[model samples]
Target chain A: MSTADRKARDKENLKALILQGAKKLFLEKGIEQTTIRNIADEIDYSVGTVYVYFKDKNAILHDIHTIGFQELGGSFTELFTIEDPMDRLRKMGIFYMKFAIENSEMYDLMFNVKAPMEFIEHSEKEEWNEGVGTFNALKNTVAQCMEKGHFKGHSLEPLSFMIWGVVHGMCCLEIRQRTKGVKFSKPETILMDGYHEFLKIIEKL
Target chain B: MSTADRKARDKENLKALILQGAKKLFLEKGIEQTTIRNIADEIDYSVGTVYVYFKDKNAILHDIHTIGFQELGGSFTELFTIEDPMDRLRKMGIFYMKFAIENSEMYDLMFNVKAPMEFIEHSEKEEWNEGVGTFNALKNTVAQCMEKGHFKGHSLEPLSFMIWGVVHGMCCLEIRQRTKGVKFSKPETILMDGYHEFLKIIEKL
Candidate 1:
């Protein structure tokens, strides 16, 4: 490879290394508690080198947020194999729930935290590509389901948004500790149980 | 009234006054932005007196969290006039959404913020009374719906929790600006439209 191409690849690799370190710290101490210095320390790099790759903490958070979505998408690879749209949608929710429960801190950064979003707002892009991309996957699945004569009489976008809300809301409530306040009979499995309840209702539709 | 009764009444009134001032400040600024000193200044009470009424910021937060629920409950009073359980449940979701949209900050405190839950965690109660009470209201309405031959074959608690997740998740996304990120077609009415989609699904059930 040319020198310029090799340098470009090395730069990308280092950027990934920095983000991996940042995510590790964030998962350990939460996004609020983790700092750029901590990330540098975790990655065994100088703070100045970290700054060379990211403008600030928000930049790192935004990148990590993107990675989180990518991970969530990666978890969905098995869903596409399910032929029936309805069945695919069901498995998708289960996979979505599993991703959220397992990677809760990453999930919170993607959905709940304000930093990554604030970074988007201040930056030039002015659109949440990660969110839109993930949302489209669900929207597409739901649209397919609609074509199969399920979810009748429902508008596509809103119906997609509603499905997103059902799963996301459960995860948000669970991660934010709102579910604990309510004291469900099965606190541990309530999320899956709640999704099952939703599944039964949607199956009728 | 006896002198002792008058003294107790005055104490209650002052406590209410403090909460009123705190709520106004919270609405004007935000919970994090509004401090104990700001609250005292707003109410023209000394910081020590504020302490006399509330043990700390969490105590004040816990009390305001209760008031937020009380206000939410007050909005639900109209639901009782509806005779049909399914219809009431629908209206309840609508009213719940309305409350979340209109009282976004207060709703965040009651549902999403950690202070109130942390207060519950550190305190002796060990149970979330306000959350349990509010959830019980929803659970009761859902149970009535099942008794009336609606929602066949669904467990009561999980069903109620899922319903809660649907509404809460919508509000959580909207308030947290996730809806803005997704760029919904009707950004302004996505929450209600989403609920309508949910309403369509449940109507079949």
Candidate 2:
């Protein structure tokens, strides 16, 4: 590899290390309590070095959210590679739940909490790609299903929101310990119920 | 007023005062930053007097949530007086949006954040009033539509969840300030889209 490529790789690795340490601290102490100094202490980096990498605590949170989205994106891509659109979507629903269950902290940051961090943008218009790539991924999959004629033509955005609202609402309650007295089916059951309902609606359209 | 009634009235009045003061502080400084002493100071009450009214800050939050729900329940009850099923439901959807818009802090406490305060149990497992009152309100209206032969024979709970899930998800996103670029159809359009689509499903059933 060229010298420039090697340097870029090294810088990416450092950023990843900082993110890992910061994420652990954020989950343990919460958004308000965790500080740059604490993250530096945990990672054995100097405070100045940490500052060189990130602007402030909120920057760290922004990076953490982006990284979470990246993971969730990968998970969706991995799970939805089935040749049939119907099969792909069914698997996508399971992947969505599995991703939530496995990455509770990051998942909360991505969807549950009011993420404190804001992004620097060039325009007044919405950059659907900037902070919303994760949700858009789900939307894209649903749109593809419709395009492939696996489902009838429904507004993919609202349908995506509906399927997400149910599953994400349940997941949010579970992660936050709020689903008291709720008659929960198995995780798979809950996930499939959303899938079945989506298919039912799709059939209507 | 009788002496006993006057005493009861004053007691209720004082509880409201403490909650108003505490809620103002909670919103201004957030939950963690707002202490009992700060609430007492905000209301110009002695710390001892504040304690007499509320055991702790959490107790105040619990009262806030209870009061919010009580008002919400009353709002829904008033909406029930309407005769047309679709019109009534459409109004109910508007009322839901109205409540969220008018009472931002209360909305946050009711749906997103759990109060740390103790809620007195008014409903046993066999008779959970909140869930029952809520779904029954929807069911009774839905029953009207069904009786009119608007919907054939579908279960109310699932239908209610569908409607609730859509409205709740929209409000949840709105309050979180996450719908930056997406302009909603007049609440009527979005609600009709989901509500009528739901009615269509019900009709098919």
Can you write out model 2's per-residue Cα lDDT over B94-151, one digit (the tens) per residue?
A: 7876787678777667666644322433223333244345646766776677677653
Interface RMSD of 2: 4.5
User: Which lDDT values do the candidates have, in the order given?
Assistant: 0.91, 0.63
List candidate 2 stretches off by more than 4 Å: A1-15, A26-41, A45-52, A116-131, A148-159, A176-178, A181-195, B1-12, B24-38, B46-52, B82-91, B116-136, B139-159, B181-205
Task: Provide C-alpha RMSD values for all models, in order.
Answer: 2.7, 5.3
lDDT of 1 by residue, A1-205 (tens): 6999999999999999999988888888888788788888998999999999888888988999999988998988878888898999999999999999899999998998887888999999879999999899999998999899987788999989998999999999999898988777789999999999998888877
All candidates: DockQ: 0.76, 0.24
Best by DockQ: 1
Error of 2 at B128 (Å): 8.3
Interface RMSD after interface superposition, each candidate: 0.7, 4.5
CAPRI verdict (incorrect, acceptable, medium, high) for model 1:
medium
Model 1 vs. true fold: TM: 0.91
Candidate 1 regions exceeding 4 Å error are A1-15, A44-53, B1-15, B45-53
